[model samples]
Target chain A: MRPGISKILAACAAWGDKTAFLDCSGASLSFAQLHELSLRLGTAFRHMLKGATGRPIAVVADRSVRCIPVLLGAALSGSFYVPLDGSLPEARRRAMLAAIQPELVVGLAEGTSEAGFRYISVDELYGTLPDADELPPVDGDMPLYGIFTSGSTGFSKLVLKSYAALMSFIKAYIETFGFSERDVLGSQIPFSFDASTKDLYTPLACGASTLIIDKGYFAQPGRLAELLRDQRVTSIVWVPSALSMLSRFGVLGHISLPDLKRVLFVGEQMPVRQLNIWREALPDALFANLYGVSENAGNCLYHVVEKSYGEDERIPLGKPFPGTQVLLLDEAGAIIPPDQPDLQGELCIGGEILALSYYNDPEATASKFVPGPPGVGRIYHTGDLARYDEAGDLVFCSRRDHQIKLHGYRIELGDIECAALACPGVDAACCLFDPGKKKLTLCYAGASGEAALRTHLKGALPAYMAPGSLVRLEKMPLNANGKTDRVALARRYCGGGDVP
Target chain B: MIESNAMKEQIISILQDILPGEDVTESTTLADDGRIDSLAVVELVTEFSIAFDVEIPFSDLVNENFNSAEAMEAMILRLQQGT
Candidate 1:
């Protein structure tokens, strides 16, 4: 590995005045400015940490140009940066901050600041700093960013990713796709999401410019289409839901994005219905399916959609990205042979793209990321089940646990259950996802009504994690194991049977 | 244009069908509020077209137009007028 950071920052000098980032709010940062600003900001962070390195620095991530520098700057501080969604319910952000116990929080709202941690504005971090040569060398193994993923426990697990993992993944991705300095990437994923790493770094790596579309525009697909067309965005890697919304509303029929060259979707399965719509509209663009987990470096597998599939056929996870290795493990922890077609096993990955560890959670880290053979690094057991097809392509079967992906967000059904149980009137809560409807319904034997439970959940969980609907049960059914009979509850309330 | 009670009631009923939670009323905040996600917004746009026979234009699909049942009623009426 190229020691990641020095090469990335040093290569920027040639791009000079090229636009590195452009926000929907009309803010733009050039490559030279981004290079200088991050170093200055890094110097400020060093001062805040009293010269201590490898500390976690929290950035109040909003969808804006300014937040980009903060992300890069935090890494330049010799510490890992954790992007916290500022718009999340204050309680949700609080719990994450408490888990990380960051050295300083950048751009946190004044009134919301906790006393134990120091807070600083993004503007304040732009101070004069040491030259690039003066800074200490950082190895590829050094932690770069920490991403929070849903945990079975109500608290999210912070996955600490190293510089080598991110750089290796980005290098393989942009190179395979042929991203160049002239390309403009349409960025849709939020800063806090691990998938967004590709956007943040791809532009920096290849001297491309990523134009961030406003979050609200997804609700109004026409505006989103307009932004892409007008800005001449050539490439985009987004969650399936955002792309589906455009086709669902017939927004594509009204607009034309002739500039778009390639479109990649990840996080969740993309229904063939919407994919067909996009393929018809942009006949020249490339459509690809990607598979990844928060525990890995954004993504590990990808398959470019070669032939149009029928609505009934599922998209294959395709092949592993360059520099990454994916394997299947049977229940007994034995590696499944690639020749065994149609034999299902839990998908596991090993290579340079694997993350360092789940921060502050040794048990989770140990259980999920088992040690790999001598030089392969640790292997990540993705909790997702898959099998090799006749063509040697990986086919996604189903999730092994209650964790589900909705609208590209990974959600633990147990995480919602844990939060529901925290409510005063809620008792014996079970959350179920009706995959047919793409909705989460929480069944509970509780004193509170739907409105009250919704209010409680709104405060406790992020909007995306909150159950779409609520059901009241006299009491939860119990199985022979003495656990809540989730199957029975799901059938009674969410199936053809009436909720009552 | 004034938001008629019938149109407002239609919008609420349509939203309730898609979201199916607590009762939606004229004052319910739909757009920015966490209650309605992006997928739900697309469904609402489709539902409005079927119910009112008016295609919501790209320019009129902003949050202000869908923030509440009353707001959607007004926007529907505006689109219905060929504006």
Candidate 2:
């Protein structure tokens, strides 16, 4: 058996009848049940392997109790898993599926069909158990999963993670949190996001119960609060937007949840305004801010909130996780001297958790994942501009790319331009994010009002990308860098308002 | 009895409240007519569910049921009756 898979299966066995998963739809599975079912599913997948050992199996399941076992089942069967968010648009979903053409697509919902792929639903796999004695043995540094990240250029690239890396990340996470079998975890991120890795895997590894909430519930913060109360969830890992919405709508204040202990927020900056509300609401909870990208497997940095946070203090993204090394390097790739607070550089992460490379996109892999100084080996260029403060905490700055994150969704400026060019009235357009309102404002040289342009954009882009305000500009302002001066644009439209 | 015109006006008012910036009217189609996107529709549905006490399924979220303020009011009435 593969070393990681063997250890996880043994952990499941050791914790025997403990609850392993709680599907929000009212289904619960115990660790013993999960182990047996995983073995059966592994044997079933082995029969379908068609002699292609170590090949990845793509999974397109929503957040459910069945997702973890299916992942473990794939690992035990000597295959990897690639998760695709089924909620995405068909075109985007097809693009991702095509990039990582897998041996099988598992756990699709009824009447939902994607063309040009063979699939088996979870219902089919668990209907009958194969003889457990005949389960296949897993071996070697075979991949455990291939998680895709948005490419620096246009397309998305898959990052194949070895079983060793996955296990190492899981080990670090378990040790950091001191998680045990008694904890009940609440998962809010989609199965596709890297944040869900901890949500889905950590609980099963510790034989704890993971409560999978439906994505639709995320839009309604009230329902999310109700789910937390009803599920008796002891821990939660979610994006800051979810917490912000919860606090804004008073759901956190009104809800009565006595069991919640650990609250982990990531995927965006956690404003102190929002954190203050959370601190008051869940006075006993251990609130943690995690920082990382998909390239580092999962989180690489974490900061636990202090009991007595000063009013003037900005929350620091504390030191790196175990087995990870962080460095602040200038544009020339020289490491900045430690204790130099004024030195701002790109955040470069190096460690065991760094992804191997972008799948099939060597040019991009070379550009971002470059070799570090002589003895340091390869490091991931985070592209995030950051500087160490006098206190040794990393303070994040704007991205080198004009990628703007509004409401936790990453928006590339190029995507807005492409969408705008598709519109009828637009000759040329540039969209800028007003951080104050968390709104996208479209400044165009063409004839279109806020209404007409909004109507046009609704057809071209997703709801979030549609401009909230339209500003007409005779010509776009460009800086010395020959790029559109976004700072000038912000000054023009924002008009000295406080930036969000 | 809630008059048909009053129901439409009430629905439009609710939509206007939910989508703060827009100038929504009785003729505004929430979907393909492009007055609103999926996120706005979700917001409208949540408000409608709370105000009228009906559960709207995610799969049933389509342009046909919410083309106009009148259509949304009619859908809400239908849902209320079915319950």
Candidate 3:
């Protein structure tokens, strides 16, 4: 057996009957029960895999205690698990499954009969107890999981993570956070997001309990706070948007969480204004701002918020983790001199925890995973513009791509453009956010207004993707790269100029 | 009774203030019509709980119980009766 797998099993055995997972249905699994379930599930998964090498297993379960054992069972069976969020569109889910060509799909839903794959329901997997000796040893170098990133260039790319990389990240997280048996970790991140890997696995690896938060609670902040206090949750990893909503509605002010020890916020830019509220509310807890892309398993840089930062300063991305190296590089891929701290450059990450590659997409893998300086190995080009401040902390500037973060959702402008083009009478369209007004505007070349366009967009896109306003345009400006001049468009639409 | 109709009007006004769009009446469903989201529901429930001095569990804050101004008022009255 692999060392990491052995260690995980040993920890589960040592923890014995202590509670390991709690679902929204009030179902709790002790460590011993979880271990036994995982072993049986692993045996069943191995039988299903039938000795296929590097096969992808798709898991379509909602947030539940069973998700952990299923994911771990897939890993133990030497199969990479691909978590598909049930909330996504069926067409998008089909596109992902078609791209990955998963060998096995496990879900609780009924209508998942796709050709060329074996579908096993959670009920069947849990009911069938196979012999423990049938479980095959998993390889550390084999792929453990694949998380899909909202691809900017048309198609979603699956970032493949190896077992060794996952173990390395887990080790780093435990060392930094000091997780133990007494801690009850709250998980709010979707399984598809890389943030869940930290929230779900790190606790189990350290013999701590994991509290699974229901999706409904996140949408409703009052219930979420109640759950936090009721569960006696000691830690949580969430995006900044959730924190912003909690503060804006005064939920934190109304409810007191006395057991929360650590709060890690990631996925988007952390607003200092909101962070201050959380710090004041949970004065004794540690607040960390983590920065990383899906290409690096989870987080590579973390900034622990101290009590002294006078609320006005923007939080830095802080230094790299123990096994990670962060390099600021120019457009030509050369490292910027350390003395020149003011120069903005793309932040590149190099470490053992770097993801394997973009699954089935060699072209993208080559483009993103480039060779670093001699002997530094492969590094992921994050495409994020940042610079080292005078205090040697990395400060984010903006994204090089056409990605815009509205509220808390990551929306690619191209996706919005594609959706708009599908609308009737829309020849071409460009969507850009007006930060000053907090409104997203769509300028189309053909015809535009709130009536026909809103109806068209409502059918094509999600509720949040619909533009708050629409403007008529003659043509979109193009730059030297032949791409839409987003900067000029932002200035023209947002600067209060007359529409054509 | 300190004007039951006035209390209903006040609750509707508060709901309109919290939720931006959509008309709110005694019969309007809070969950439907997109008038109140999860966060808004929590805020509204907290405001009602504090104003009425009732301990309302989060699980009870559902569409069936507090879907409308009248329903919420009835819930508050029941809690008052219990006390």
**TM-score to true structure, per model:** 0.80, 0.73, 0.73
For every model in order, the TM-score on chain A comes to 0.80, 0.78, 0.80
DockQ for the candidates, in order = 0.26, 0.10, 0.11
Which RMSD values do the candidates have, in order?
Answer: 10.0, 10.6, 10.8
lDDT of 3 by residue, A171-257 (tens): 888889889888989887789888788877776678888888876665566677888999999998887756665664567888999
Better of 2 and 3 by lDDT: 3
Q: After superposition, how far is residue A475 of candidate 2 from its true place, in Å?
A: 25
Q: Which parts of model 1 have CA positions greater than 4 angstroms off?
A: A108-112, A129-134, A152-155, A373-377, A402-500, B1-3, B10-37, B46-59, B78-83
DockQ, candidate 3, comes to 0.11
User: For residues B1-83, could you state the per-residue lDDT of candidate 2 as single tens digits?
Assistant: 36677777778787776555666684555555445543355456556655566776533455666667767777777777777
Which tens-of-lDDT digit does each residue in A443-489 have in candidate 1? 88645678887898898889999888888764455442124666677
Docking verdict class for candidate 2: incorrect
**C-alpha lDDT values of all predictions:** 0.79, 0.71, 0.75
lDDT of 2 by residue, A108-165 (tens): 4755566897878877887656565555556635567778775433346788767666
On a 0 to 1 TM-score scale, where does candidate 1 land against the true structure? 0.80
Candidate 1: clashing pairs of residues: none
Query: What are the interface RMSDs of all the models?
Result: 9.1, 11.8, 12.4
